[model samples]
Target: MPDGNRQIVLTSRPTGWVAPENFELREGTVPEPGSGDVLVRNIFMSLDPYMRGRMNEAKSYASSFEIGEVLQARVIGEVAASKNDGYAAGDIVFGMLGWEDYSLAKGAASLRHVDAELAPLPYYLGALGMPGMTAWIGLREIGQPKAGETLFVSAASGAVGQIAGQIGRIRGCRVVGSAGSDAKAAYVADELGFDAAFNYKTAESYLAALQERCPDGLDVYFDNVGGAMLDAALEVANPFARFVECGMISQYNLVEREGVQNLVYLTRKRIRMQGFIVSDHSDLLPEFMAEMAGWLESGEVKYRVDVADGLENAPATFIAMLKGENFGKQVVRIGPDS
Candidate 1:
């Protein structure tokens, strides 16, 4: 037996910037399950920066989205019906379930049972999930921040950046962050324990601002926005500095990204720069979650969420996030799972 489902599909692709009109909400019949399948009712949905890359047909680390397909997102849902031996009807799981109220998943290994006892179901899509995992590995494996060293992060109040700064602080680094607004900057510095944070939008000279705050120079630069910020950090690098290229939100909208005028500084400073994605390092998830869970339980870590009330608002909320309108991790609450 198949149950009817409602879903939001990508009606059109964004040529430059995404608009809410680019998405369409449609009601459809729920798919039937095969022998090894489950029907799920989604409770929470995630909005992420990487989804912007998916909107384009350009080649990248991930595949581009096909027009008219359901917009993809990580979701937390309850299994309403199940035929898979590994799962049961009442199991609450988190996975890539797309933007929908319900879905039929057949042998979807990405879907895993979630422990609601660990945190709220929404957390699987935010702090305690992929974003958190990305921060842990980027800081530990790539950035390699050292105690008493200056660690700089852009988009510091976002899902990944927030955790990255916290992790750096835990490692005894002097962490500084750049955010879009004063409030966000204050939150990163005051609440997240970043040694210093600035509103990048208002700063006239990034290098000068960083120099004023991080007089010791940056040993680790966890980059979220590329372009001038990278160039600025390059000029302020300490000997053998490390740069973690996690994202380039600043260049995503531009047809031609700005160049780093200070490339010579990298050679002069002996800096090591690298890029990484969490999907490629899935092996680290088990250990990462255990550590993150312990941090949360011990009050060493804190997370913030910017949530929208319903699935219908998901498109606008996602668009707002891309424009830096969201204060923290952007999530959508779909109807309650039964």
Candidate 2:
């Protein structure tokens, strides 16, 4: 059995956007596993932009938070003790754990055992996990990017965005991406093989910047930062273009959501703009895992991570990620393997 536990809880709901004060740190003795449950020691806890939605007491694809409840997240852990038949001590798995030093795996259905030989454990939470699945489905299934098409992605250096651009490149598309800084832009363009990249923060105007990179026209837009980037993409979209709306980090902290003035351009371009949640594509997870694994093994796809050292920093990491401070996928290291 585990001897110690530390965790982060949502002490208060954020009125408009998340604040550091909303999180509270707590510690206690780790409880032992019971029948059908496995006591797991957390190694890596994932911090993502989606956690912001969970901070507000509002309805969305997932449930909102209640004050003082421990925030939910995905974590990779090793079984310290187990009463479950399928899992035993020292087995590594990833599941919907939370911001904690220890967690109980309730059952085997959602928890997936991982092979570290195949990839690093943290990769299970990033490239081989939800974010990777998101990029795959958004590009191939929703956007349907084809060979020679011009593709654009916002938040291009982020976990999902980086993967999305790589997927676009793999499809033989001419890909351009926008990031928050020059360094991030270079990471996408030079390291990630984006055809062109720009720092959206310094770009005079969104439309002008996108037009400069995609002069011919954008055939597919994998939108991560919604507001101006979406509006700009709409302006340069060719006839029959597709826009996969994955996330909207640009307006996430705004008290009032920014309205796009160029939405009318979508009509003229006959663009198909659609929003998607990853749960909607559960049927494709197995297929995506197979393909992404192949891509990883062959070095066709690569990823980066900005990891914080403790669970107590989860909130700060999440808030920073929304502000474009994190260079890659943000994750928190909670405890060491037993």
Candidate 3:
């Protein structure tokens, strides 16, 4: 067993964009599991866009990460010690742990055993986890896509967008996606079975691109990158279109968020634009997991992962992810699976 636990702490809050300097790595004594507590040695840690919002002191759906405290994230770990009856040493578990080598899970609510034989441990943090669940709930409940209808997803090659686009295809919708690069666009269209995709970076105009690709107009818009993309989507939306507002990565770092100019189209077209937090829809997780597991097993849905080695690299990896440098779902490998 390791003598100490390593953790990343938020040193300062970012004014605009997050920097590596905002974080500090510290080593401390490994925590021991008390009664009803389980000590887990983390193997993987998920880095997501939502964490950006948590950095700020302002209130949101989740609480802010306090400075000088260990950052929290969805982590997959192996039980190192256990005082809880439900868990034992050598058990693989998934939970909301911290950005550290070892975490002490207090109760059953904090951890759940994961089957390593079913899938790779990392998949529990990506496709079978929060990102996958986000895609499922947002598309099915909010987007409400129909067969032969047109669906457009912004940030199409991203964690949520990739799964959302595939789900749209399963529903028999013509799925169109917008990515940051030509390669990413191609991967979404060719590899992930998107009907059409465009590189938003090189496109002459978002409206023109959408017009060219989605000639029939969009019936559902699974929005991830907002700003001008959201405006363009609104302009090309059909009457009674459903806009599933997932995340706005484009405006996350900006001091002033960009306003949508084509919102007038929303009223004219009778569009329904609804934003959601994935945790609020946990009621659907059981159904989602059953369906998603089948799709994955049947090769109907595919996923990609962008892994960064070591907990020390998490700060830089997180910054790059915010800038769209990551190709897929970004996660950190803190320790070996064994």
The residue-by-residue lDDT of candidate 1 on 139-161, one tens digit each, is 88889888999999999999999
Candidate 3 weakest lDDT stretch, 10 residues: 106-115
Better of 1 and 2 by lDDT: 1
List, residue by residue over 1-338, the lDDT tens digit for candidate 2.
54668878889877666788989888877877778988888899888888788777678998887777677889999988889999988999888986888887776547878887898788888899999899998887779999999999999999899999999999999999999899999999999999999998999998899999998899999999888788878888999999999999877778899998887877887888888998888898889889989999999988898888878777888888777899988888887754
Residue-pair clashes per candidate = 1, 0, 0
TM-score for each candidate, following the candidate numbering:
0.97, 0.97, 0.99
Off by over 4 Å in 1: 1-4
Candidate 3, pairs of clashing residues: none
Per-residue lDDT of model 3, residues 110-201, tens digit only? 69888788777778888899999999999878999999999999888888999999999999999999999999999999999999999999
How many angstroms is residue 98 displaced in model 1 relative to the true structure, after the best TM-score fit? 0.9
Top model by TM-score, which number? 3
lDDT measured at residue 132 in model 2 versus the true structure, 0 to 100:
89
Check candidate 1 and list the clashing pairs: 5-30
Task: Give the Cα RMSD of candidate 1.
Answer: 1.5
